[model samples]
Target: MTTQQSAIYYPAGEIEEFLPQIGRVVEIKDHELAVFRTSDGTIFAAENRNPHPKGGPLAEGIVSGYYLYDPLYDWKIDLNTGLVQAPDQGQVQMYPVKVENGQVWVAL
Candidate 1:
């Protein structure tokens, strides 16, 4: 049996404030994650996990065509890569997010 680590907690309200500015990437525990805006102003949160063992930091990574590139190893991984990064082998899970009346709602 495999044991999954504890899920990290991020205050949605605080994250929302940074959404309009430069995207913010944060790491909780050993997980790498980021919140950023596309060229079209759509905000998204994605895990920073890298497929390569020597994966770069996701917060400092780059996003291109729905994929995040590790800054250190230059590994191009899908934004939806979830907890694991692989070459068409793994997928990232997404949470339902929405902003209402100046409040951010992230379905856990």
Candidate 2:
């Protein structure tokens, strides 16, 4: 599947609040996304809800490279593609994020 869908990108917030290696939840309309800003200044957005049975908090998950580890079920979800990698797995819906002029835009 395509990484980014053709949709309007809504302004979430500035670059400062989204620190490196930290993930935060951003809500727009009926959508909720787990937005992460990597140490290298790259940003990735994905569905806040987990695919596991417990439905862990993905936003608070640990970030290692381009993968986000689920907090509850412990799944390594790809920050860019949202593919669950190895061990126990399931796919989490991924979204598009664009940073322009130090502002974060989310395409839901």
Tell me, by lDDT, which candidate is best.
2
Residue pairs with clashing backbones, model 2: none
The ten-residue window of minimal lDDT in model 2 covers 1-10
lDDT of 1 by residue, 1-108 (tens): 111244333445543465442446555445445665555545566654444555444566666555655667645555543433544344444544444555443443
Clash counts for all predictions: 4, 0
Provide TM-scores for the models.
Answer: 0.53, 0.89
Residue 93 displacement in candidate 2 (angstroms): 0.8
Model 2 spans with C-alpha error above 4 angstroms: 1-6
- Consecutive 10-residue window with the lowest summed lDDT within model 1: 1-10
* Best TM-score among the predictions, by candidate number: 2
lDDT for every model?
0.50, 0.82
